[model samples]
Target: MTYDPTNTPAWKRLLTIETMFKEGNERDRLAREAAATAASFPRVIARYLTDAGKALGDKALAVTVTETGPRDDEGRSAFTVGNCTVCPAATTEFWETAIYGGYESDVRLTVTEAAQGAEQVVRRWAEAHATRCRELPVEG
Candidate 1:
């Protein structure tokens, strides 16, 4: 599938923008930061969904975030964001890459992670989407 950050939920978009501005060279640190940021996006979406209730699935929104590298198996860490409601979820496997005598590493996540990640992401999206959906003024 294809990964499009632009179409991500608004709150998620803010999270990604923050992550991009963050400064870090360590793969784990960056992944942790990214995961934390991603964790928040879903919460925001869920909050809105809870408020909106019924209007959800009709305009269901999903978001995805992916961080690639920092590898060699044996308990390596990966980071990513996934949302299908707004755009198609990705479908590539995450890969861990090691480089420069272990001085540098990258976390690569597959599109499939979107599937695994969606469950959590969607719940969060629903909550927030619900809230926002309720607030939308009647278009009639």
Candidate 2:
């Protein structure tokens, strides 16, 4: 356990701080992520699928490499889905901002790795899922 002054008891905090600062054994890896923020969060890598026909629930799926940092400054990306009831019955419409894409959080990966992982998830999910909206047969 880290002994952050603010997070630990008065005595343990100082001791932990001394141990970390003096020995550098438990130094938190905050330096690497200092500049990272929600607004400035470099995506590193991502995968996307444009709805074009609004077939997918949300125009596209935002398959992105997940990283924890900064804060929830952006709140959350707005998302929407297409109406499936109409299918071939009538025209349907929907709007969305960002779609859900499974994240790889176990290990921090290089940009290339992140991109590959993201695309893999996007493709897998997109292929596995089915679209309810279908075109009706044209009259001969």
What TM-score, computed on C-alpha atoms, does each candidate reach? Answer: 0.22, 0.23
Positional deviation of residue 25's Cα in model 2 after best superposition, in angstroms? 46
Evaluated with lDDT, which candidate comes out highest? Answer: 1
Q: Write one digit per residue (lDDT tens) for candidate 1, span 5-85.
A: 766798698987778766444667968876766565322222222232244454333333333432222353443333334
Residue by residue across 5-114, what tens digits does model 2's lDDT show? 66558878788878879666334444334444445643323233333235445533322223222223233332112212223221111111111223425444444344
- The lowest-lDDT stretch of 10 consecutive residues in candidate 2 is 90-99
Instruction: Give the whole-model CA lDDT for all candidates, comma-separated.
Output: 0.40, 0.35
Evaluated against the true structure, the overall lDDT of model 1 is 0.40
- lDDT score of residue 12 within candidate 2: 82
Q: With candidate 2 superimposed using the best TM-score fit, by how many Å does residue 58's alpha carbon deviate from the native? A: 21
What TM-score does structure 1 among the candidates reach? Answer: 0.22
Off by over 4 Å in 1: 1-106, 136-139
Error of 2 at 94 (Å): 22
TM-score of 2: 0.23
